[model samples]
Target: MTAAVAVIGTGTAAGWGRHRLGRLVAEQTPERAWFHVHPPHHDLWGAREPVVCDAQLLDCFAAGLRAELPVVVSAAPPKPDGPTQRSYAGLAALSRPSGRILVGVHPADAARVPFAAAGCGLLSRAVPGLPTGAREVHGEVAVEALPGWMVGTDASGEPVTVNLPPGATVLVCGAGAAEVVSTVAVTGRTVGSVAGADVA
Candidate 1:
């Protein structure tokens, strides 16, 4: 298990978003008000590994894990399909580990996954009154010292204030060829961000 988080992305318009790209493009509309969550700073001394997962696997993931660890799930928008929106509640439930945090990504995902779920504490983010369910932690605050499990995302530039350290291993999921190089440049890690299209 690598130290990583799911970082799921969804949008009404297809071209505006993708799980592979770290940027979320929302045109000038109410949807633009959605929130995005960034990855937690690397905690070298900590013993927990943050594993990224598909939103489909959230419920079953907690079965064999440490109960005391935290899970920081991203609150991105849900797919416009009815079935996709309905199934999101389970994923939202998984985000509520003992210690949790919310980073803005999408309004639909954020609405379904609130901080008041099963085992969540008071939620917080960078904006005031933005993330309705969680408490607001204004400004650029660091969560590196937190000792527990965490799952989250790097939706775009709005929430990601910290970049990954050097020598980190990343599995890129989609791209033709050039995208792989760009992800490596931004992340500064030797292991590249796997292109979404390349995943077979």
Candidate 2:
């Protein structure tokens, strides 16, 4: 009754696109991605807080969750509107139990919550040859290699790159990994990625 997960930021042209910050004047597309779902216990380790983000480039891509655990910074969700393009485009995590990790880019609730990460992993194949490895859903956990990367808009800011493998144990669902990935090849902004306990 007290485990958390929620990271959903669909803003900008619609809502949730890496927090879409006033682009040229703002006004992307895809209806600005909605923006919602981020509740790691009332906005990250709650205590009635707002405006979290001490900044430091968040150790450049989580830096393994702030050089090995322990972080502080909340409040960075508001795609007021711009050349917006975000509904679920990258960034969405939900791993808490004190470990605290619900990154949905912005909005809250691990991007509209739909979490389930049992164990062993590796779910990437909706087409293109197939064969990544790791399996065992419902029958009792066994998923691995939840890997895949390629965020967006670098020079303008907001870019995450991480495509690891080899004995992997990951959790990087940017844009909810395009609603369950399947082979990941997003154009921009994600609006879905639900795992009912499989997908790696």
Candidate 3:
């Protein structure tokens, strides 16, 4: 069956988190073909193709669904100030019932993401103590590498952390944070082989 993971939030942190989470989901489920919907700023290493525009994104999701693959989408949170909120809503609308939504937000802005919390299956952040639910993945910094941060969580809910090479924090806040977001992305998947396909 077709599955999808949408990483939605605001600012550069959200962007980087989306990239990290998408990669993690892809890694967890390599048996199926994967498509990506990412902004121009982010670079996706492996994907059958890159989907641009809302129409193309929807089309890719539909195609992946038909092919029983997975579509990884990175979108801005559905907020009034967010430029791509409409796209986020569209993705949410289309991925209902079986799709997963991972919302990444700053700890201070936790209360501001009410719209997403209504439907999101996972919440990723640097700190813990969010309103309790079965869908929250809390992350905290455990160490500070020379140029990277090691994020880990000891929260009661699902723990999301991944091991990464030192100083690999280019696109994400840190490797640890990336792992946290990614853990939420693939929380319950079995988790890729299209080569040379245009990954925009």
Candidate 4:
């Protein structure tokens, strides 16, 4: 049997002192789903991308994420939706950062987090070889999918390719999480599959 898998999105909840880490489990009894998690308050708020937090809260969250098959999907918003919009400014606190990613992936697991840092327009470049049909929240761009990977034009309009791994889920929030997880619930596949079965 496949081990339990969990996906989490980090952000500061509006009107709350604690930070929120939205969790999506693929092995709920009734049905797999996303649950709201309000961790203890920490002074490390409003830091830069891949924000770090208090060791206590970070350890707690990290412990919760650990499993036989653990997967943490921390979504760092490239740009804030608005002044009031929640964002994951503290992901690096819980996970280590190599270059631009804050992550915790089991080496045996075929999972990777390749996302663009703030101000970079071509998000697809972060995860080279993305399939077609990648929906950019900020722009309308057409991308093509190769047989084993994907290709898209980057900030300088240069062709960039990305190869997404199986079971990779794009970290999202609220309604977006619901939509993405619902599809996973029905199909028994990751959102990356929706992007293209070749990758997932």
- Scored by lDDT, the top model is 1
RMSD score of candidate 1 (Å):
19.3
Best by TM-score: 1
Please give the distance, in angstroms, between residue 18's alpha carbon in candidate 4 and its true position after superposition.
38
User: What order do candidates take by lDDT, descending?
Assistant: 1, 3, 4, 2
Q: Write the per-residue lDDT of candidate 2 for residues 70-124, one digit (tens) a residue.
A: 1221222222132222332324221111111122222232222232111101111
Model 2 scores a C-alpha lDDT of: 0.25
Q: Which scores greater on lDDT, model 1 or model 3?
A: 1
Q: Tell me how far the alpha carbon of residue 190 in candidate 3 is from the true structure, in angstroms, after superposition.
A: 22
Q: Could you tell which candidate, 1 or 3, scores higher by TM-score?
A: 1
With a 3 Å backbone cut-off (N, CA, C), the pairs that clash in candidate 4 are 52-93, 128-161, 128-162, 128-163, 129-150, 129-161, 129-162, 129-163
What are the TM-scores, per candidate, against the unseen true structure? 0.21, 0.17, 0.16, 0.17
Stretches off by above 4 angstroms in model 1 are 1-24, 28-33, 36-44, 57-200
Q: How good is model 2 by TM-score?
A: 0.17
> Any runs in candidate 4 off by more than 4 Å, and if so which?
1-50, 67-99, 107-200
Q: Write the per-residue lDDT of candidate 3 for residues 28-95, one digit (tens) a residue.
A: 43333212112121222211122223334333433433322122323222232233433323333322
lDDT of each: 0.29, 0.25, 0.28, 0.25
The ten-residue window of minimal lDDT in model 4 covers 32-41
Tell me the deviation in Å of residue 176 in model 4. Answer: 27
